[model samples]
Target: MDENTAFPGASDESKAEYILSNVAEVVERILTFVPTKSLLKMTCVCKLWRNCARRVLRVQQNMTWVSASGPSNCDGHALCPKLADEVENIYILPKTVLVMVDSETFNGQDCCYKQKKARKSHHGPDSIEELNGLFPKGCDIMGVATPGIVLTPTGSHSGAPKEFQEGEAGYAIMFPRMEGVDIRPFHFCKNTISEANLVEAGLVNNTDLRVVLLFGYDAFKPGAARFLNQVLEPLARSKVLIAGGHVENVFSPKRKCCDRGSYGVVGLTLSGPKIQGASVLLEQDVSSAKAAEAIIQRLKAANLPERNTLGFMFACVGRGHNYYNNQRNVEADTFRKVFPNIPLFGFFGNGEIGCDRIVKEDYNLCDMDSDGLQHGYTTVMTLVHLG
Candidate 1:
């Protein structure tokens, strides 16, 4: 039978249905190449398009950083509802950490009080009360620390610990619920192995230049080389500090309490060799431009896609405008020079978290390898190839 004759009696509604079915298939293919923000907007086009976009656009992982003036005045809580409106679920970094927003300085106690109030208001009554009940008396709420000089989102100051000021407060949200990607957390204890053994363990391979290291108070005090030597030893020539610092991992339920013993290094690891990392220690002589160059070289070596790649930057609060001679956003600006049009989001963390390498075995929450590490005075960058 002729093609036209086959559907000659089809009603207008039937023809429209046929056209939409074909269009839906085409849209599914197109959605694969659409960036996340664009895909979210596409959901508003129509219900059919929304369903297709939702099915096609899978966000395997999402990390968002938000900042506002002081803790009491900050709107960091708004990030939750905003993200919930877009994605199915989210996991926030348990602490509502504070960063120095402006040049004014204040005391740590005052900053802590304001931060506590911020968390109470942001997390709501029940979650905060539950967290409080977990700790014994005299311990501060979850993620609340004595305010100190920390990295700011503005990127204009060097990460210097000035007296606490009437600055901004912010926190990070990490969501790994996307499809087609496996997100897991791993932890590596300090001095657990020799340099040779770490390499043998596949934790410090030659291609593994980007690893997040979170040192406890004892470990962080020894200086940068001490911590760098633990994983980046022998291959000390490669750039690795994309995100890390002195922050402790209090959120992990595996730990009994939020104390120094719980303060080891943890990180998320990817499955392939395409990823590379570079770090700049503000305390060292390295410049932000130089650090960005190291990452550029690594990306070139990997032959990463020029587009559709995403970047997450975790910088020390001390490395902003203060470090770059009052210059504005030098750290992020330098990174953009290489991955110019890619999507990037991160915050100036008291400590930054980034992954190193993937684990081979399956794991549950209680038995997972590591959650990631926290470090101070460093910038950790993670790059993912989406195409």
Candidate 2:
């Protein structure tokens, strides 16, 4: 058979379209085997091909993960079946799980949660067990219940990569893990490095990223500058990607009361080889529009690769649509203006740790502003370059 025997006189584009159409529709399993990059490229081949290829991607993604929000008290336990139903294959279990709940959602007992449904009662430990059931094996679980609006990822949150691009990423933490009490995350901000807590947070010399959550007040204490510097300096020297934030209203003297005591850090140290990335903590004492514009400028300057990227944005709740004249998702909107294809997820917090480093040469950009890692007004955006 000659190259295009069945469509001998067909134009090359027509032949290509025909082949893609048949593959995308008829041999759908083959489409599943296709790389996401290639599938995305196929979408641009033409409208008909685009629809066919995209349907397959959508179907596959729908089978693999779920996104839920708006009021019901859905913890990891309630999450497993929805997860099993959505995902075709299980992504790897995380080395750890980070839980963020509004102070209301977390009952005083054992971090277990009551119902988000109209009528319900449930045990916190049992809920944890149900969540652990979602994992293939026993893995460390930690959490924070905040007095401010609590934020959490709706679907899969594969742990952050450990090591990236032949080196470790940046890192930091606020409080130490609570002693003896299993599964309770720290809620303080001693951000410095002491021998005991390093073991608690699991920091090693060779790692890619670590996320630390601090109580808002501890972020303001006297030694915060020194502690955060000690925590970030070595990682910066090794050229790692670091990002963090403080729990809002959790420790403010006038803030709503929370079950956990007033100090400590909940740190998740991510160290693995499958992903590499950068962080740009953009800040300025200016209008919301101007501040977002400044972030956009710095992102452009970073010049990240335009493919296989996901963004994690930790913005101060202080600056949102209201801050942008009641416009919604302004930070997300501006970030998309820079990398429209990248999916972004994160929280609005009391304060954050931000940096701007695209490559090894950009290491100096990893440090927070002169005031230090915990600041009330900066947008910390990180680009996870999928490996």
Candidate 3:
């Protein structure tokens, strides 16, 4: 059997399909063997191979981290003053789960690692090789063979490996996990861009992308406008017009006129070229009801197509009652007002991703920007269309 020769009794299309399928299978195995950045380069072997392999490398799900604290023991008091003081400022549980650790805990070190190692070594042979085998086949997340370490992002003590290297390749891999919730954590280093680099790495192309999800950090600073614009400007100016193209996708919730004291206010800002003719209701000092009402009215006024558009929502984890006493208060209600009956699911993201192309605007060399950095008490929501 010659390496260049086609299989007997097979047409060109069948032979090509066989080659492409073999490449995909090989790529799947290679995900465990190499880093994501390297895997994308293999796509150049062939067109069909690149397209299918790309999907295997991209982050398919959104992840969220929730923080909570439990009662701690003190020598004399029912509540530990140390934990009480910490909760007083944050007003949420500092510990997401019950941690059995020594009283002598260090500030920089996660004492849990010691306990985890002890448990693993005494039972199963615990190593990165063993951990990687635990990943279910065909499930996304690179299926890389490594000891999985989940981390908490907004904790006094963040949890993640200080450094981890892949087998023999010596390339460092950063695995980010959300400790408190079910949402899958998609870890990305500071532009190290291994498996998570979507754009330049060519993992998931814009043509395959049906929706662009966005999530902001804690507080929305005026300065973040630049970062938000960076992602939005490019999409607005894309040759491949977005599904809603800005106009059809915008929505506004109905406002409640009655007094709901101290209730958090949610305002929708559907700006840039994404919303074709849609106008945002930028009303300040208004009650939650008024703001929501204005949004709905404006959504109808935009005169866009009404389709079955919804599958996911993007909001900050801190914005919803995860930080307050009210559940599904502002975020859940806002989506209901606009879409009425579409399913809404999203996570509170540390940062958001959208196109930097701003429609109807002239620009050159659209470089990536992180100007949308924010922290504390803000919710940026987006309605996703799950094809």
TM-score per prediction, in order, is 0.49, 0.56, 0.32
Residue-wise lDDT of candidate 1 within 84-140, one digit each (tens)? 343332222212221112212111221111122232333333322333343224322
Q: Give the top-scoring candidate (TM-score).
A: 2
What residue runs in model 1 are displaced by over 4 Å at the alpha carbon?
1-4, 16-76, 88-182, 188-243, 248-261, 277-283, 286-304, 349-387
RMSD in angstroms between candidate 2 and the native structure over all alpha carbons = 13.1
| Over 4 Å off, model 3 | 1-136, 141-187, 194-210, 214-287, 296-308, 321-328, 349-376
Instruction: Give the runs in model 2 whose Cα sits over 4 Å from its true position.
Output: 1-65, 73-127, 140-193, 196-204, 207-230, 236-238, 248-262, 272-274, 284-286, 306-308, 360-371
| Tens digit per residue, CA lDDT, model 2, 1-387 | 876788888998998777766654554555567644466666776776677666665544211123323233454323334433433333222334444333333332443222222112342445444444543344454444333231223332332211111111111111112221122233224433465655455443434333332333344456555665655555455455666676532211111222233333444444334345677766745446557767666766665664544566766767655456766656666666666555554556667765666543334344434345556666677775433
lDDT sort, best first = 2, 1, 3
Which scores greater on lDDT, model 1 or model 2? Answer: 2
lDDT tens digits by residue: candidate 3, 24-68: 665455443443444556678776557655555443222222221
**The 10-residue segment with the lowest total lDDT in model 2:** 163-172
Query: Would you give me the overall lDDT of model 1?
Result: 0.40
